[model samples]
Structures are given as C-alpha cells and as structure tokens.
Target: MIMMDEIVLFNPGDSIGNFHDYHEAVQTAQIYQERHTESGHVVVVKSDNGAPSFDIFLAEQQLDNGQKNPSTSKRYTISKKL
Candidate 1:
C-alpha cells in the first residue's frame, strides 16, 4: 500500500478538510478556529508514528459503535487549539 502523508482538520463528528500541504492545512484550521469560537477543532497529521488519525478513528468508531482503539492506525494531532 502507498502511504501518503496528509493533514486532516477534525471536529469530532465533523471533518472540515484534508490537505497534503502542512502550511495550508494549518492556516485553514486556524482560520476555522478563529471563526468558530465555541466549536472544538484539531489538526491531525498522518504519519509513520503509531497514533490513530482522527479521520480513520471516526470511521472505525462508527463501525464499532463509538468505541476507540488507537492501535489500529497511524496518525498524530498537531494542534488541538488550531
């Protein structure tokens, strides 16, 4: 399988966007955060490191009836404040 690194803008049940470029994703996340004060958002990066991507987690959660198991995929959050 081909592994492509990606940045995903996540908000629990909703996903804002996915970006291949880090800077663009960060800028977009920051802008979204600035516009939505009460909403919680996080910027997640897909990497080789052993962490679950927010997007993948969401999909898995849906299949598992809201259960979370981190060992299934690889991703890490860059910023929860952005």
Candidate 2:
C-alpha cells in the first residue's frame, strides 16, 4: 500500500482532460474508485516521493489557517472551517 506520508499528487485529469482543483480532483478519483470497486476491480499501487505523491491523510479536507507558514510560525494548527 502507498504510504500517505511518502508523497503522491497525481491529478485525475489526463493530458486530454481539462484542469481541476483539489475538490474536483478528490471527487474525480473517488468516482473512479467507486466504478472500479463496483466492477470487482482493485486498484492498489505504491506512492512515490515526488510531485505526483501527496499524503492522503493530509490531503483530506482540513482547513488550517492557524497553521502558520514555516517561515512565520514554528508550531500551530490551521483554522479550518468545520
């Protein structure tokens, strides 16, 4: 299983597809997962420590205004919208 901590950020949109942001991105991936799952297919792969890799745990919708930039504050939580 790919470690969310490692790094993975592959946008579902392909070269022929249009651009999409975080929310759209997640929805798209989930949609694909649902389809594959319904078809009795399992898509499991390893995450890479590169641009195409991101922490899903961290990727989850979490507002973090309290979490200041490392350049500004050292330790703090983000003021995310509930």
Misplaced by over 4 Å in model 2 are 1-5, 8-19, 38-82
Model 2 per-residue lDDT tens digits across residues 1-82: 8733322222232111121243443444456556555433222222332333211222232224454432432121121111
Give the top-scoring candidate (lDDT): 1
Model 1: per-residue Cα lDDT over 2-66, one tens digit each: 95544333234335665566666666767766777666544444433444332222221222223
lDDT of 2: 0.29
TM-score for each prediction?
Answer: 0.44, 0.28
Q: How many backbone clashes does candidate 1 have?
A: 1
Each candidate: what lDDT?
0.44, 0.29
Candidate 1, after superposition: displacement of residue 37 in Å?
A: 0.6
